[model samples]
Target chain A: MKDYIQKMQTGGDIVSAITAFVEESKKINEDNHYFTVITEAQAIEQAKNIQKQALTKKFPLAGLPFTVKDGICVQGVETTASSAILKGYKPVFNATAVQRMIDAGAIFIGKTVQDEFGFGALGITQGKGFQAPKHPDDPELCCGGSSSGGGGFTKKIPGAHASLGESTGGSIEAPAAFCGVVGLCPTYSRVSRYGLLDYGTSLDKIGPLTKTLPEAATILQVIAGHDKKDETSSQEPVPDYAASLGNIKGLRIAKIKEAFAEGVDESIKNSVHEKLTELEKQGATVREVSLPSLKEGIATYFTIALSEASTNLAKYCGMRYGQSGSMNTSFDEYFTKIRTHHMGEEAKRRVLIGTFARMAGYRDAFYNKALKVRTKIIQEYKQAFKACDVLSSPTMPILPPKQTEAHNLTPLQHLMCDVLTVGPNLAGLPHVSVPAGKAGIMFIADHFKEEELFRTHAE
Target chain B: MITQDVLDKVAKNARLTLTKEEAAQFLPQLDEVLTHFSTLQDVDTEGVEPSFLPVKLSTEMREDLPEECLTQEEALKNAQSKNGYIKGPKSV
Candidate 1:
């Protein structure tokens, strides 16, 4: 990683990185590791610029090589969101998170794959004209997504130290769990969302996926904090996250019983249980806690997610921007053709639910009620946190299903995989999903207390 | 109860075209989903304040100030089509 950084500092171009990445990616791609490898000369220019800043010690992320989910805007490069509608669309301004990383001296390695528009739990949801990519270790397995490419790149892209990905439900955690990496989903508004391509606005957050918790902490320190461009950004002072990594002795942790139930895969449950035992041995107090609200998390998550998604996606009419097609004489015809031609199955699915829930008669009955229920769910978590300083659970109920098996599962079944993740997202709490043994376990804390959570669980 | 027709309508409204076969497959699945959510109804939240953000926050109200924003040209560069105002597909 240091050599890669030095290479960039010494005027090494992105072409070299791209060449190395592509060669490495080809091997991984044969194992189904990635979807596409970005090869534009512009990446070289970006790397060189970042390198110059790094040499001056002006940037925290100087000389670091990173990948971003394809959904994020990187000026002059196609921000596909893994969708065909915006296949060649290139943004002129960077997403606030990407720009921040760039300003911190991080080199852009490439754009990684995602479920189209960061929509799905399983990584396979691609937009019109695209297909889901597979995993590096097993072609039949999934990489876990809407941040699949980012997760895949973290594992397979040679000399690539870390990557940025997004999460609505478990996009970051699921992939990290499957790929055996560290995924941090900061409290909502922890990172600015200025140029993020939306799927679910209220729940969406950009975060880092890295090999270790310390690296994640460092990356979060650099990319986090307020950006005026993003309405949802929090103005709170970004804490010294790296400085908080200390001894975990005497910390209180609660293991959610629902996350380790009979329905959970045996191997994953056992592995997580053993990790908790290790944490106990390390002087942390661990006890089982019941969170009945979590059982409803997936359903409530979808209600809120889809309702938000419906309105958020309305901006994609082909007449203004994005992919356009045959001219329609009527307004309805125009929308139908553009959306019909552009949106993938998953995007359409959520939009329909969202639109219906937000419709005139149904808004109060469905959308508002869902929000009320979401409030109640949040309350439950707040109450739970009173009993423990941090909450722990398996990131996913089971190991990632094979990509082929993923398509076979119903969408609701797929959503169930996020049962452990959605609660933290709904409550706007900070959480980190770290690799523990084979499966990943999530550690969640009250909002803005991510430092506390990370300090207690660093491995 | 989520029915096949409801599912189909939801799918269409969302702009997804699903075969009858797929609808049949998802109907029971969605029913199970809603059934699971029924668990939340048992929790009493009568007096609890709805938590919007986990952290207590007050929206920062700022005095109007000039700030750098992407030029209209730069913003429109990514737009599929543009006129004086950003153009989107006509909606009924």
Candidate 2:
């Protein structure tokens, strides 16, 4: 990313660069099916304006181009979150983060495909009619999701590009690990969620996926902060994220003991441990810490996320945006028809389960209990952070699985793929997944302390 | 405990129609996931407060000031409208 910026500073023609990029992306996007919509004309126009004014060095983002996950609204662009129900719907306003990116002069390239409504851990559950993005390393294997397409595109594209990815549970991290990119998911509400299609209202966060940690930090500097547009947006002051990009000499790393336990592949553990030792040579300390509530992460996460999702999704009836069906039937029946026809299998599954969980008789036992359990988990993490600067673990339990392997998994198996990631996500902590050896080693920092994630280096 | 009847009722409450095959296919799987969720019952959360959001956030109230907002055209762009208002199924 810095190299690309240097080129622009050295009088590289922004228009020419952006035009060539769009043409290159167009050729590659045809075969990969990662991009849902490439905003070539808009991007080139911005590039032309930037170059005409000779303003490359003036804007922090300069000529850098970034992709947005399908969920985040880019004004006048279809923001479906890859769900068929919202295929033709374009928002009137850019999401706060996207607006920030544009204001900082980052070129908007395209939208990438994702799991329907950010519902799946594996990329396979793209809303019916959308193709799931594959791992950049191999076409046959599935990229992790629900920021699946952005992860692959960020990894595959060369020279100074990033993707703005949103995460409910482990959407960004999982895909970053699988696609071998740096995915930095900020603490909940650290960035505004305004204009982002809601999944789990409280759990969703917007972050950047890039090839390098510094690039991720730079994007965070551009997007992270309070925005009145998102009521849930934090009132906390934004820190100098770029300033924190160096020197983890005294950093303390806490290895989540359970993360290395059974169900995790042995090679992943060794690789993550190896990365930890390498970080130690930079004078960082490592220690094992027990987070017992980690065992409850997956169940607790799905319970809360989907329950919120069901309510959030209720707004997508035939009367509003997205899909509309025959109005001849009663209102309820009409809505049922539109949703039944448009929502994918996973979407139906999540909504039904969410509805059942939030039902009167079961709400107390499932939804309420999950919330309390979440509190306990948060406390558990707080206790762990007391002894260490950040938590360490393999970003995914297993390496990126083949499309066939991902296809064969039952719903339960697919949900469990988020085992290592859901812990921090459920806690709403800031975390980043950096590819290390055979697996991605994820470093998680406490809520609103995203700068700490930058202090640790990848090299 | 999510029986076929419960699943149907849940689907109805959510305003989502599931074909008989979908219901048959989904019910057992939903039951399986819920069964796993049932394990949470064993966690001792005797008096723990629920964390609705992980961060402790206070209610933020904005002054009710009207500013330039989405124009009617923009607001109704995605809606199916008869005149200007969003169109809905017959209510009469």
Q: Estimate each model's TM-score.
A: 0.91, 0.98
**Tens-digit lDDT track of model 2 for A70-174:** 999999999898998997998999999999988877789999999999988889899979997767889998888999999999988877798999999999999
Task: Pick out the ten consecutive residues of candidate 2 chain B with the lowest summed lDDT.
Answer: B83-92
Model 1 misplacement above 4 A = A1-37, A158-160, A457-459, B2-43, B47-55, B80-92
Model 1 residue A397 lDDT score: 80
Model 1 agreement with the true structure over B1-92: per-residue lDDT tens digits: 67676776676665555667656765676577556544555555566554444455567777798878778777677654446465544455
lDDT of each: 0.75, 0.89
* Per-candidate fnat, comma-separated: 0.43, 0.81
For candidate 1, what is the DockQ-based docking class? acceptable
- Alpha-carbon DockQ of candidate 2: 0.80
The alpha-carbon RMSD over the true interface for every model, in angstroms, is 3.1, 1.2
Candidate 1: residue B25 lDDT (0-100): 61
